[model samples]
Target: MTLSFSPSRPAYLGVVRVSAWYDLVVTAGFATPWSYALLHGGLSSVGDALGLGVLPALDPIQTLYANLMGSVVVVWALLRLVRPLAVHGLFDGAARSLFAMWQAYALAHGAMKLLWVFLAVEVGFGLAQLLPWWPSRSNEVEPALQGR
Candidate 1:
């Protein structure tokens, strides 16, 4: 019997990349509708109900722009993950940068809960890249040493 070990760094990265892409796609699809609804429906009613002194009207163009910006940021973050650079240096740096930007955006928008969720996802992805998974060794019989 023999034991062999294999590392799965590439596969881990591939899964991360796929997850990132899926996020981007879903967000992109949701962005337009959400922004439109926020601008047209919620903002005014919420502002009036809260007596926020005539909140600024939502601009569809601005909403679209913000959505595009978010998509771009997310894509950049994904790229950082997929880049074939040193795990510790380039990948980590890029991930941190992107996550910081996301946090800032969320804070600016008063979306703390969303920000936390995004932060968690970002941290999880970074940790996945940082952690190494060593393959399990197979059980094998070994001979005992004899002493005179």
Candidate 2:
């Protein structure tokens, strides 16, 4: 058995780059607590821009929760940029996939309709992270043959 990690293809890497940038701007909205003015507007003049249907009104608790979640997302985004090809990067993408699935499920069940956008974006980013690493028997065996 053998292994190789010569970095992913450029197309996949480009997808990750775009995804990271999107994460930056979107997570900023979550952490800032003042980006809920665009589009249809949020619960307040400035609330969750995504307008979480669950938290239709931004109270103290909602504010605290949003900030906390956003902070974590910021850290994850930084990690994605810093180590895009690292093993943990796969985990990061997988986590986003899960988040997307949850949001899609909620939207389908008539919960948070606003999550529709998230479902699409998350799935796209997740596929970018995951699909590139798919392994082939040739990839596993070719390196060993070349080395020998």
Candidate 3:
């Protein structure tokens, strides 16, 4: 007798893809407001000391362009997940590799940190495929596998 694992549900994949897309959209939306607050609301003091002052000084147009480009990349990732066949192997593989790296970063860096919570959620989205279909007890053996 042998136990078997089933393929993941389509709904799970859909949820993961949608969640990733939503995260990208929300982050893009916040970029402008956050950048504005950082530039004009006293954040420059700390940024200047940290040698990161140049970022906040970016004009709104420049910021929007950067954010839009980032959003496009994220959307591309989501589309790959939703329809893997539509993307070429090299591009899909690269996106998946990057997604894995981002997940590792989120986990190793401590997700509880304010800036990392979104990363944590992104990790969850990527890992949705690993969720178990049903709870199991360590000592339990199913009838199908009992003889093996």
Highest lDDT against the true fold, candidate: 2
lDDT of 2: 0.60
In order of appearance, the predictions have TM-scores of: 0.42, 0.66, 0.39
lDDT digits (tens) for residues 52-140 of candidate 2? 55435456676666778777887777766775643444565788878887787777776655566677889877876665445653453
Comparing 1 and 2 on TM-score, the stronger one: 2
Candidate order (lDDT): 2, 1, 3
lDDT at 50, model 2: 48
Using TM-score as the yardstick, the better of models 1 and 3 is 1
lDDT of 3 by residue, 43-130 (tens): 4465456554423454667567646655576666566455643112223334444766865675575432332444455455544433
lDDT of each: 0.48, 0.60, 0.45
Instruction: State, as a TM-score between 0 and 1, how close model 2 is to the true structure.
Output: 0.66
lDDT of 1 by residue, 7-85 (tens): 1224544644554665565355335647545544554565456654333455667677667766664665466456622
